[model samples]
Target: MLSNQIRKYTTGIILIVIVVLISVLLFFRKTQLNPVTGKKQHINLTHQQEIELGLECAPDMAARFGGLYSNTDIKNKVKVIGQKLVAVRQVSKSPYQFDFHILADSQMVNTFSFPGGQIFITRGLLKLLKTDDEIAIILSHEIGHVMGRHTTEKLSGFDILEKFKDSTHVITNYSPNQINSYITDLLKITFDSEEESEADELALKYMVEAGYNPKAFPEILEKLSGKSEIPGAEDFLNRHPVPENRIENLKSTIIKYHKRK
Candidate 1:
């Protein structure tokens, strides 16, 4: 009887090992070439699926920030700038439909993008920007997130997939209990320093191509970074942390951009 028990335990361990190996293989096998970077990345969702997911989730996201902004003129301005940025070569080539919206929340200085090009900026952040170029810098950065497929790439991570599997289900099918959690997960989906840096670079490239001065980026960074020093700006600081090195890198990128022009 003891020998039989040992044989069963060993077989179970082997099965577990095989299952883990297969999961890893399947995860690694789902790679697609990034159009902008020209590098292969592991992405489980197709471009169409990303578009569908973003479209499905956008209304829920907008609702969280008190729905769309009220001012007609400002709303049109944001959309015009976004469309111009999207018209640039680096971003226009992508198979994504871009739309820009201003959230009604006037107390939060935040901006975010959904996969396949649904971008949003809060009114608080919008008011802080001084000029059209500054606005372009912010919008272009969100566009960079779309161009980089940062959200989808983050979702494809093995550990993230495990944690969000239930939420992922909610993404496709509405579950009253799980809806809030799914939106929360989307809010928490932020990029690391490296990814942020790439987005910054892409933002600069788009800004330059869209006929906006790339120099506005440094000013924009300084303007946003200054918020962290204020006591009541915790919300802005959390969502948009601007470290000194990022500014330094932006400066270097600007030099390279000018050289290419």
Candidate 2:
């Protein structure tokens, strides 16, 4: 009886290991070519699906920030700058359609983009921007996020993470907290900083192509770095890259861009 029990336990472990290996392999196997970046990436959603998801979530996102900004001229200006960036060949040929919006929130200095191309800048962040080109810097960076397909890649990551978590839980019978800790330690992913750097690099290229001043890159980073809301060292693991590192990376990328020109 003891021998049979041991055999059953060994077989269960083998099955779980096979399931985990297959899951990881399947996750890595899912790939699509990113049009703008010209690199292959793992993504679970089609361009149309990403666009639909963005459009569906945008209204709620704006509402959370007290809806869109009310100034017509400001709205038009932001839209035009975004259009100029999108018109750059690298961006123009991409599958995403870009739309820019200004949020009414004047206290939060933030800019972000959704999966497809729904980009937003809070009024507080806009107020700090001193020029149209500065605006372009922010918009282009968000454009980079969209073009990079970071959101869908994240979605894919989560999907695989859930599967792995389920498989492990079945094998170990770990408590919820233990499983959470196990997963966190198993994959302490730090892709955000890399993605931020990529976006900054893309922004530099797009700005130069679109005829925006690359000088504004550092200027805006400097201004943003001074903001109280910018992530500090303690927030490193939880938030986006610290502004100081981003400024340094931006400077190096700008130098590279100038050399290319």
Candidate 3:
């Protein structure tokens, strides 16, 4: 009887702890500055905290696919192109150090970035592109993720995802198998489709703002869709994939900018 009472108390204490911890997180103090979109955010992290976090993971990130490229020429080329995409652009205004790299891997098609301005690509994705413009699009898309603070937005997502007692928390463990936590990873990726589309729009604006032809946006989308010349694409078609609709948005961006210009 005494042991049963003790077990009940322990369970109750654990539940109380979890509740308090989550409550503290929810009301976690946030700052007023918004760097990426200039809109206020409920983030409790400072820019310095963000920069430190990026640097901390950077080495492992570099080592992801054989410790970055030994090919200076290829690596330099990727950096040059990446710099051009952010060249004289708003993202260039970032005070933290900005660096770009292409991994030595041949089995990945992913392009991703870290908050402190670390951009990465796989040689696999590089070989897939038929033009520098396509490369620009990919890097800029990743950059869009950075400049738009999509990852940061996703961080908030973790907090939100955790609020539901049933949802629980699961993080990806990128160890021997890399995607050991694939389920949570995919769950986190289950963002509102509108965020994805908004990021694409920003990508187009930033690309053209960086002087690459905006057409590269849809062109790469077409290629990714795997049916550029088939009158419709398999990528991003939605339940009813429509490239023309997206193209129209890209086309009107300049006009919208000019109205503000």
Candidate 4:
């Protein structure tokens, strides 16, 4: 009986040591610099891995939003603007392959991007946009998320390998409820307000490079702030810096980047 007890304690000690070792390895492995932001970031996934993950998850994500929008004109417009954003030398140099999608859900006023480069904006958010420049602003902001590799940076802090053992199961096996909950949690994840601010700055730069007015970025944020009392808009608002704060920062960015000498 004593021998069995001793063996059980030894096994427990071995498991604890293994867990600690894995944690240490993950910490050390994650200290690479972000290509776009030029900041040291902890991201476990490679650009290729992030792209594959986004591609695998894209179909399921669209399904959750009641599938893709049926309007070819709107769809084509988003694709064109997204491509223009990528055409900017700064964005074009990145490793991600950006793709834009318009979600059919008209009640959710939000825009989001998966790691790598799959960006989606709901029709509800599209309805709020008053010009092509507004669309450019939104898509470029998402492009910033992709370029910043924010999603994988979030995943790096967790036991990503354990959570996505097969990786393929991230899209294939999870139930709709499970996927929704997982994505909701991910969307809630943030990298301080600095990251959002940086994305805004990037959006401004990209919009200007694409020949859209940087002022439109701030205009859309103001519009969203006015409509914040709407139910589903919380996803966009809560996850971002307050619109007033963003507008203030954006003014500084516009002066620094967009002002004529």
Candidate 5:
């Protein structure tokens, strides 16, 4: 019995070492330079693959938000502004094709982006914006998320992949719906505080480059602060940095950019 116990312990150690070795191999093999951020990242998916995945998941995401908004004018407005930002910003020179949509949900006040460039804003959030610049700020921020490849980077992390591998029941038995749900859950995972700050900085730069007033960035954040009685404001706050903190960071960013100019 003692010999059997020792053997089991030895086998467990061997399995742990094997897992570590495989993770290390995957890490080195997948490391690639992110074009927009100029930082090396361990991403397992190509730009095309990211775009394809976004496309596959877009329908399901839209359905969750009550399908795409039926208003042509609102849809066109979002598309126009989104395209304008992408056209003028240097970071938008990536391989991902950017598309923007408005969700029909009038009660969920939030915005988000998919891996490759699909951005969506809810009608509920749209009604709160006071200016076109504020709209630009929102879209530019989502653009920053795409440009930074936050979703893919988060998904490709060693820990997440390991968890996914362990949880997956069969290698080839997963359905498209299951894959979509998995990716959707992954996307729902909030960006860390540092990432949120970085995306804000990116958005500020993009807005400035695109000739939008940098002040609008913080102004919108202030509007979205805790004082607001918006229906989904609490949910938004939970997923994002505190408004005061974001505003302070944006102020510093604006000062630095102005000094450079």
Candidate 6:
């Protein structure tokens, strides 16, 4: 009887393992090609899904900090600046649909973007910038984040999100903390390490290609370093902080691509 029970238990375990393996295989098979990033990605959200998600979350983001900037003219001016930066020939094929907004906050000193081209800048950071060059520098970096599909890649890791959606369970919006994580962690990570280096290089390229000074990015970086909110935000200004070699790498990339104009 004991032997019989052991056999039954082993068979059940094998069945469970097979089911899990099948589930995992199905999950991986859902991976699709990312048009923006130009790679096959494991993201569970479609392009339409990403657009809908960005549109849905945008309202709460604006409302969280007293809504968008009140002045329509200033809003239009900001949009114009962003468009100027994007108009560069190098970015013509970029998938970003830029929507520039100046946030109401007066303390945060950062400009950020979402996976599907949702762009935002705190008034604090905007007030700090002195010229169109600085704004272009910041926007170019944010555009890199959008093009890299950073948040979408991060969300792919949260298997719970994928599983829930896959299971057809109800979906609701994230709370403030969740939003912060996506903005600061997921999106930030894209701008944080190697990805950060890529964005910085892209920013410099975008600047020069736009006929603005190529040095604008590092100059803006120097300015951002002075009034950063987080202690390590200083490190952010320097794309490659740890090895201390990123600056040189950046310089080399700039020189190599200097004739890109």
Best by lDDT: 1
Residue 158 in candidate 6, Cα distance off native in Å: 4.0
For residues 1-261, write the lDDT of model 5, one tens digit per residue: 999999999999999999999999867777779767788886776776667667767777888889999989878887887888898747556788889999898887788888888888888889888777889989999888888888778776534234333232313334566666655676466877777887888888888888777776776777677665567765566656564677888888988988987
Model 1: clashing residue pairs?
A: none
- Give the candidate order by descending TM-score: 1, 5, 4, 2, 6, 3
Query: Across residues 41-130, which tens digit of lDDT does each residue of candidate 4 receive?
Result: 866666777776677678878988999999999899999989999999998988888999999999998888988899999998898887
TM-score, prediction 5: 0.81
Per residue, candidate 1 scores C-alpha lDDT tens digits across 1-261 of: 999999999999999999999998776667678978776777877776677667777888889999999899999999999999999986788889999999998888888888888898988889877789989999998898888888788776534234343232223554544446545776887678877887888888888888998787876677667743533245655665778998888888889888886
- Candidate 3's residue-wise lDDT over 150-209, tens digit each? 565556444322332222233332343332232234223432444556667667677777
Report the alpha-carbon TM-score of model 3 versus the true structure: 0.65
**Alpha-carbon local distance difference test for all models:** 0.79, 0.73, 0.60, 0.78, 0.77, 0.65
Q: TM-score: which candidate is best?
A: 1
Off by over 4 Å in 5: 1-23, 157-176, 259-261
Whose lDDT is higher: candidate 3's or candidate 6's? 6
Off by over 4 Å in 1: 1-21, 157-179, 227-233
Clash totals for all candidate models: 0, 0, 1, 0, 0, 0
Between the candidate structures 1 and 6, which one is better when assessed by TM-score? Answer: 1
Q: Which stretches of candidate 4 lie over 4 Å from their true place?
A: 1-26, 158-184, 227-231
Candidate 6 structure quality by residue, lDDT tens digits, 189-226: 42456667766767776777776665555545544555
Whole-model alpha-carbon lDDT for candidate 6: 0.65
Candidate 1: residue 128 Cα off by (Å): 0.4
Which model, 4 or 5, shows the larger lDDT?
4
Which candidate order results from sorting by lDDT in descending order? 1, 4, 5, 2, 6, 3
